[model samples]
Target chain A: MTERKLIVSRRKLLRVGALGAGGLMLSGCDSLNRSEGFRSLLEGAEDLHKGFQRLGGEGALAREFAPSDMSPVFRANGNREIADSAYRQMLAGGFADWALKVDGLVEKPLVLPLAALQSLPQRQQITRHDCVEGWSAIGKWQGPQLSRILDMAGLKPQARYIVFHCADRFGSTPYYESIDLIDAFHPQTILAWRMNDALLPERHGAPIRLRVERQLGYKHAKFVMRIEARDSLAGLHGGKGGYWEDSGDYAWHAGI
Target chain B: MSEAVTSDHFKGGDFVRRHRLSTRIWHWINAVAVLVMLMSGLMIFNAHPRLYWGEYGANSDPAWFEIGSNADGQGLVKIGDATIETTGVLGVWTDSEGVVKKRAFPGWATIPSNYSLADARLWHLAFAWVLGLGVVTYLFWSLLNGHLWRDIRMSRAELHPKHVWHDISEHARLRFPTGAAALKYNILQKLAYSGVLLVLLPVVVVTGLAMSPGMDAWMPWITQVFGGRQSARSVHFLCAFGLVAFFLVHIAMVVLAGPINEVRSMITGNYRLPKDREEG
Candidate 1:
């Protein structure tokens, strides 16, 4: 009889204990779910994100090279070149007629030919390309600094971002990417014209490609056809900027 | 009925049988995932071959102790024909000379740097995604169904120091009062589970992601949070330590609780409760 009573009392105590534990856990959940606190946390996280970008300043550009460090095998990732007839024809002609059209929010819209781009003072750099899928390769790249081109075209004061329009298309929509002015004028930022002392191959981005060296492989926009300076990206295709950005929700600032 | 008779065979009462199918699947999956993660994680850690923190980075000065070879020539032993060497600045060391040496710090075996970091990273990342998805889905399901707020949650009464002390004392004596007493998870289980889920997992994920150069742009705070990339790596290892500790305690508890019945319920999603022998 005494054992039965002890068990009954213990059972009641256990119930109370469980109830107490449940209450503590709820308080923790409440802290996490608080609207204002959560929002502030996100804002703080974004600020820290920007701070990192600033820390890797324009001076933090990838090292320039003398064509020696280029890998003997610069294995191409994904498609070598678009199978589209138009792109193929351009490639056949050695891309002499190709021009990089810079327009949108620039004071002086310019259609600079590939030859004209080469005439400008060029910078060469050896840098590592880190792929998002987790591989890294060091290669040599030579090109005009993007800052000089933007300056030549004369970006409008209102222009806050520069969008790279590429010849490569995922399907019906052509591939395009955008970056804020901070990245736009970064000294390391260049429109690479040559790789390993040779003209950029069709498999690579033939006439021109943007080498935002600080970012991942996807950010390296190849087959550049146009440059659009803009304040707002809301009007762009899918409003996310890049193909992967639209499809995979890739974070816009893919800096390492 | 047959079901009732079968239910009477297990200890812990009817509550033990109430685990849902989803819960059972997640439980076993987590078990397997954790084991794989731990083993692979250990193998990866072996590469760096040494552990340190704060101002004491892997190559930092004030040399704590170095692995591989040492001046004292201690902590060396032959396993099979291969002569393996060990040394210490602290703790104890047996040298290649068959002499035992003692010091303030211990030199550890340089993990055989055999595996490719890239491959190890691939395995770690892929398994991490599986672990992450499982956790996210489990948390979401539990929250939606109020399980988070109810089952594993602690009530105000349980928070009382006196109550906690009483439970601790009871646990020390191995006197688990059965029946309705077993209806809810004990306070110890609640604390351990909550710590593992809420704290350790997040720390592990954050430290791991922080080490990535790709996400460094959007999540630079990771570097700041963990001091630097190397520090983040250290923290990641520490968090792994905490997780392994929790896992050991968890397995031990399951064994003590009744390994066969616990394992069966987790696997088969059914448990027979223990009843009075007289009633049978």
Candidate 2:
């Protein structure tokens, strides 16, 4: 009877010990997460990845899939619709009057209406959109090359980053994103006005969206209102160059 | 205590250098790195909680596997048409704070102990550099030092079915190698180590790279080899769990073979071989 009691108590002790150890570990990790210095050490890995990603030519193009390979229903994410009065009015009129303002550090500041953008040279390719959340979707995006537009508005010597000020707002702050010259001038980088052989839907960033194919989905700013070329990303909202990057502490360079 | 007994070259029953400095260093670093990577990777997986095949997969698409909570808040892991309840472990669990969470994989099993995809990615990518570089350097150093060929590489004789079966049966019976025999790895050990080092580690790294959109531009063939990005992700997930399974078995083996002696061998490179019971 005493031996049986000992066996049961020993098992209970073992169970308690295991749970205690597990709890310690979990809390230990949480404390580490709270440490600012440790967080920086972790974030420092991004520089190594940035260097590694740049090893291949900056002009490298993401893989383009076949027509049938496109997702049947490309899931729309983030801000699907804008409740802003101006944005809603533009959407109601089929974005006919909407014009993308190209300014800041450019030799020529221009405002090209939707019709004007459609008149430019258009290139369409089916490419995969990888989200930071770890899902992927393929869709054919058609638009004039961003490089062509950049060339038309001649980038200034100081201009290094291209910022897209989007129409939609997440709670009050408008959605915005920026890319360095390498990605800004990428062949696949375009202000897409059409998706899957149809005009861009409101849910999928109507009028236009920036498709920086090589980067993650969050880097691809939707419902773009203005394109501004700048020397640096500093002094912008939260100064991280992208809405998600600023708000959620997402990596500015999301090539992965 | 006699001076001879404590001396490095002391006359003893059986004391030998079992691990190289390179192997010991890499082993410990890899232990921490793999744990961090796996935990953080689980947190990342929680964001989607679904797995699919082909180049594209999203919420609307049919996933071959998923972990989610039904409307009743009961955690369920679904594989095709089959469903398994995973309550209090995956899909739903009470965190240490006593707050209920509906995320796939409990907080205890994930890094940060809370939901933060950004933080998880930070931990994962950072250690990925360590893990990636460690593998490359270890493999290179092992090859140069003859550690790969002399220790891990299976001989033709050892690869024979009879030899492998003998090792397996002995292992099943908990009859580990004794004295001098303990110095050299048996067929089962060789196979397990080589499988992890040569096949599993390399496959996980390549599959991880395949998931990168930037890598698609530089190495399109990688995605093709895995069938698609999602397929590569599935392969990555499987290989990670494979490593976890190996880790469990490895820990069990260490415990069964005498934890103190086995752990000390890896740490100090000196092993005290198990005594031969039949000799007595």
Candidate 3:
């Protein structure tokens, strides 16, 4: 009788917990439905999206397709040419002097040259790149996993966000993007140096570019020049994390 | 049984419950949600005026449908080899500032009444939460209450060609059922409602999910079932248009059949039965 009572009570508790979780989800949607301000609506909806994805996406890997499924033309989106003289010089010397500086809240600061990056063990993935403008293209990318670099850098306990500084600039604003540690540690996240078995071209961000497979196109930072680990995104450009987020209405987190 | 009231001028007149409370609530909420989603979605579609098939499509790829303006400043919508001019409307229209611009889906119909894809997405995703959740919950509740079988499901008699033909012709003539018959759905009504509920709604949601790269991780079959991302998008695009067409027909039927009674029935759940004609 005692054992039976305990099991019944535990089942009741489980029922209540499920009801509460469902109610909480409803309230999250309710606020988005009721909010009048655009910014509040944006923030609330984004959080809802993040929470929904986090529940089921912890260990899930993005779907990979066969090489035969690759798109014939993977059009490079955003800023076609870099006007900066330093980037041109790096291009001229074939990125011989170019190096990615990884600093900020890290136990060890490391600057890895292009050659050093290529020397690391690489993971090749053929994944589709989805653009916010409603276009998709599949391309194979090979590079060192971002998790490996973070392991080598040894992030300090205070580190919460990893910001990517880039050589490419859109108009006057230098391009940059940031991601939470969860995304930073994803196995598929890589600083790719090669596309389709060839060296990464300038239009696709040479030397190295970040390939976050699960996100929209803009989050894949091209012409990446630096990586900084930080505690908060508060003081970053536009305080929202990415160049597009600052200038346009693009969501900083494009997981959806 | 024809029951005559104290006044025998009208026979078999009575009040009937046409919709449940939950159904009414879902219906009203869906009205707002679908409108918001549709308008914002138009703005998102404006970002890419061209539509294609297969796995990939961009400026370089061959397009099956496109909205563009010609050199003489005339707007046109092109689908395959055929083209139709739509100046001052879809392809080319002046904004609030009165400056003529070449754009798909003019500003008025879009959210914010401006060209902001970011804000448009915010509105789209925001209302999509309501639209998606409402449908799912409503369907669940409907099943538990046997509302699907009791009301939505058609009877064997309903599938008879003669019964369907009668309903279709009556609806075409703008003549609706009266008295006790008005309590249950006619054949045409059941077909339209079932089409919207079981077919169009699910197709739009699935194809929309298939477009999301994140969802690709969760359900690879979502993309696979639709063939590819671009193919899914095209299907999603067509389904949305189908929904809009349904909405137009719904509104028109309501108006022609007597908006006061139809709208009141949906709102308050009490419908006043139309007068029965004798010798019919």
Best by DockQ: 2
lDDT of 1 by residue, A71-141 (tens): 44565664468888877887889777678899999989999988898999998877656555433445778
Who is ahead in lDDT, 1 or 3?
A: 3
Question: TM-score for all predictions?
Answer: 0.49, 0.93, 0.89
**Model 3 CA deviation exceeding 4 Å by range:** A1-38, B1-13, B277-280
| Alpha carbon lDDT at B126, candidate 2 | 91
Model 3 residue B77 CA deviation in Å: 1.9
Q: What lDDT score goes with residue A213 in model 2?
A: 89
Give the true-structure RMSD of model 1.
Answer: 16.4
**Candidate order (TM-score):** 2, 3, 1
Can you tell me which runs of candidate 1 are displaced by over 4 Å?
A1-48, A55-59, A62-72, B1-280
DockQ of candidate 3 is: 0.25
Q: On residues B223-249, what C-alpha lDDT tens digit does candidate 1 reach at each position?
A: 557765446666777788799899888
**Across residues B1-280, which tens digit of lDDT does each residue of candidate 2 receive?**
1112223443224667778889999998998889889999999999999999888899999999999999998999999999999999989899887998999998889997789999999999899888888998999998998888877888899999999998899999998887666667788888889888988888888898899888888888998899999999999998999999899999899989976567767877767768777754
Which candidate number maximizes lDDT?
2
Candidate 3 residue lDDT tens string, A49-153: 767777887557888889998888888998767888988999999999989999999999999999999999999999989889888888999999999999999
Q: Which scores greater on DockQ, model 1 or model 2?
A: 2
- Per-residue CA lDDT of model 3 for B122-210, tens digit only, reads 88877778888888898898889877777779989899999999888988787788766766677788888888888887788778778
Candidate 3 chain A weakest ten by summed lDDT: A25-34
